[model samples]
Target: MTSTPPLRQQCPPGACDCHRERLLENPDADLRILLLTRNEEQRLLERLENLKDLADLQRMQQKLQEQLGIRLHIAPGFNEVRTTRGIEFDFEDQPGLCRKTRQAIPAAIRRSMEKNPEIAWRLLDSHDLLGGL
Candidate 1:
């Protein structure tokens, strides 16, 4: 182990313009409280967004059911973007929602192609479909 060095002459608070003079930047109780508050706000916003999405999705599902006379259940928290072409659905339901999703794909494709005649089904996931890379 190396020997500890003894303290030299001490310099006062204003000795250097480092972080020692910063305001409200201390990692103390106040900082912890502030961080917690911010996190809580973000969580609340996320929950509100989730609720909005779920409600909108329910309305869309009702419309589809009325039109097609079939039940299509979408897993919660899925993000969807509706464009002039069609609805772009995104979710993490890797194994659960495939059957229901497949039912919607054909109609979605038809709507997309009808709106934009240039749409190619084989290249649905291509960069051009997403406004280029």
Candidate 2:
């Protein structure tokens, strides 16, 4: 007497629901994060950083527009456009921090001063920025 093979072996490739059964057997098997490689994790972190930067730039643009009474847009790669009372102008956003303002800012911390008083302030304040100070 010959015994029957397993159900999967008995059926042709597309004739069985074995694939669905395997998935239903383990629900979390479909989660991509569980299979992420080191490179994938790094890429995800970089993408998050880029998203944060874009959000910061947009917030700065909004504040500048309110302060200057203009319609302002800050685009990527050093480009800015402002429209005031129907007059529009474009400008390149170059780093304009004075040499003194670019110095070690420990004194600023001691004084509890958060604003830069010359250019932009820190978007995110964290211990990492202090470099273990």
Question: Evaluated with TM-score, which candidate comes out highest?
Answer: 1
Worst 10 residues of 2 by lDDT: 80-89
**What are the per-residue Cα lDDT tens digits for candidate 2 across 14-114?**
54432434543575543221222334434433432333333444454464344322233322122221211121223322122112211212222212222
Model 1 RMSD, rounded to 1 decimal: 22.0
* Deviation of model 2 at 26, angstroms: 2.1
TM-score against native, each model? 0.21, 0.20
In terms of TM-score, how similar is model 1 to the real structure?
0.21
- lDDT computed for candidate 2: 0.29
Candidate 1 lDDT, 1-133, residue by residue in tens: 9984331222245543213223234444122212223344345334323333334435645653453233454321223334323434343222112233343344453444454444332233343344553
Off by over 4 Å in 1: 1-52, 76-133
- What TM-score should be assigned to candidate 2? 0.20
